[model samples]
Target: MEIPIMFEESDAVEGHHDGLVISLPVAKEHGSSANIIMLDTLKHMNIDEKNIIIKSTMLVGFSGETKKTSGEITLATYAKGVNLQVKFLVIDTLSSYNIILSRPWIHEIRAIPSTYH
Candidate 1:
């Protein structure tokens, strides 16, 4: 379900919202190497479908279980007054966390997970 928000169409994608801020809940994994997002979340956010690249990825879980990915997408994500173009591996993991911010994101943000939390 899409959360209702009032904003100009141009400001929505431009990051020039003049102080508009939106919050999205997600999980962060310091141990994980790559960022991952639920396929359903991509659809709900109206992202990844238009510019998704067909690339398969193999992921090994903490317990050594494996999952194959369907595709990947690079999107400009805004948070805390910062705009970053982040890459996310797409898969139907059905996780409670729609997006898992991992090492790549943590490093990009120049933040230590231990201290961040």
Candidate 2:
């Protein structure tokens, strides 16, 4: 399914609560830059501040607006019998979703994220 992001669209998926977040391998590599978690989400997740990698990266939106990353952290994430050590890019910017699961993680798990609404 195609998800609209800015003027362009990304294969990146933001799932709803009821859908199982498991992935099946796909050949496309479109969402290489997906899977971002807001810093606010990280705060509630109880992650130690020491674990944040200071080497920040810059992310450009579909509309060409860039968002500078705050930091990064690799978490031992488990979902639907899948254990993935997910490295989440931390962003302090405002967004509607807590996390956008995509790319390597999606391909690894074969994710078909739940309906957006």
Candidate 3:
């Protein structure tokens, strides 16, 4: 099945949700800056902050033990007639992409990423 792609600009990323947030390439050789969501992004998406999961270890760098960010928020994706809820950590910085999908979200949605289109 070929999945449709949707992009949005929320002072953050402008790419498909793909069940996971994907940040632009960071300074590293083959890594990204950060895979986090901003407060404004959540507000723009109209996702309530209370619904966020707080701290998620699914994030690449997060340990999911201590409180790292202000908090996390939950955002729902309506794609292919499916309503999926995703948790995002709230950040206050800037990057090429605002949000990046983590392992948890990808696993939840059971999605696979392709680079050779």
Candidate 4:
């Protein structure tokens, strides 16, 4: 099948991580319809198909190569009412966390994660 080209060969942007990226629910809202979890896998995601954004089509076998998307996904945790519409990529490799939390997500949520704190 011929996959239609979606993204152009644009200059690489600054602060781009070449690994997994995911959304983390920080706070919870009352009377919400969505479930917020710490980590979300592809099989357990509630994707909004109506708003699909093509990030890129892979053609290689490397650790950096991952499926990308520009879609909004509901997190399973606190602050479940808010929907995170940031760009996230998926990697089928070993990772400490389900979502890598890319720079875009950090900037959007204005959060700081501490390691072993």
Candidate 5:
């Protein structure tokens, strides 16, 4: 039920076109649902289905508490005016990992923070 932080130096970057990587833990109970939800969320966000990619890998460690079963999902796509690059979503079920969201070009038209007023 806990989310751990997972990221590597290579995965981190500052730019819209730069590749963005995200990692998260997938519990056996919620793994399937999590994947579905994630994909649905992306679709809702208007991301092209062809641009998204998903993959799974096995991670080995000495932690007895570790699930020994982990998986990663990478979502890469481009956005207009965003200098789009690559975005990744990773899930480590055993470690209760974290999900990182990144983008290169995030612009705020009004620095004052838009208010409905």
Candidate 6:
């Protein structure tokens, strides 16, 4: 089995959005449970399929070789919704797991509230 290394979610929110973050432990030994956890997480988060983006980061072995992969899926191809932006972040570890889901928060500048004397 393969394990995740890191998973994090930002407090970002948008229209009709779904986000998933998953992390698993890394092992010096090969064949960890991380891969399975990642797949399961993806399956669980993928509601429409078209609007999902899967970003995966993997670190393995005693040498700690890290790999990064990303892909985008469109729910429209599956006859689901159109232009939905669902983000998925997966990290594999060898000992632990972490998962987070949050809306994509956008930062904007606004004037401070005026104080009355």
TM-score of each: 0.64, 0.65, 0.47, 0.35, 0.24, 0.24
Which regions in candidate 6 have their CA more than 4 angstroms from the true location?
A: 1-37, 54-63, 72-117
Which residue runs of candidate 2 sit more than 4 Å off their true CA positions?
1-32, 113-117
C-alpha root-mean-square deviation, candidate 4? 15.4
Comparing 4 and 6 on lDDT, the stronger one? 4
Q: Which ten residues in a row have the lowest lDDT in candidate 3?
A: 25-34
Q: Tell me the TM-score of model 6.
A: 0.24
Q: Which stretches of candidate 1 lie over 4 Å from their true place?
A: 1-31, 48-50, 112-117
> Where in model 3 is the C-alpha error above 4 Å?
1-35, 46-67
lDDT of each: 0.65, 0.65, 0.51, 0.39, 0.34, 0.32
Clashing pairs in 4: 27-78, 27-79, 28-78, 28-79, 35-76, 36-75, 36-76, 36-77, 37-76, 37-77
Q: Name the Cα RMSD for model 6.
A: 17.3
Off by over 4 Å in 4: 1-23, 26-40, 46-83, 90-97
TM-score of 2: 0.65
* Candidate 6: 10-residue stretch with minimal lDDT: 105-114
Collision count for each candidate, in order: 0, 5, 6, 10, 14, 30
lDDT of 4 by residue, 59-89 (tens): 2323655433333343334323445643344
Of the two candidates 4 and 6, the one with more favorable TM-score, higher being better, is 4
lDDT of 2 at 86: 78
Candidate 3, 1-117: lDDT as tens digits: 978764434434445454433333222112023336766666666556675666643334435433246666655554333456655567654545556666665555555554322
Candidate 2 Cα RMSD after full superposition onto the native fold (Å): 10.7
Which residue window of length 10 is worst by lDDT in model 4?
30-39
Write down the RMSD of all candidates, one decimal each: 13.8, 10.7, 11.7, 15.4, 16.0, 17.3
Please give, for residues 23-101, the per-residue lDDT of candidate 2 as tens digits: 3211111124566778876776666667789768898887999889988877666656676677878899777666766
Residue by residue across 3-96, what tens digits does model 1's lDDT show? 6544455433443334322244332221178878888887777664766787998999889999999888876666554567778888877876
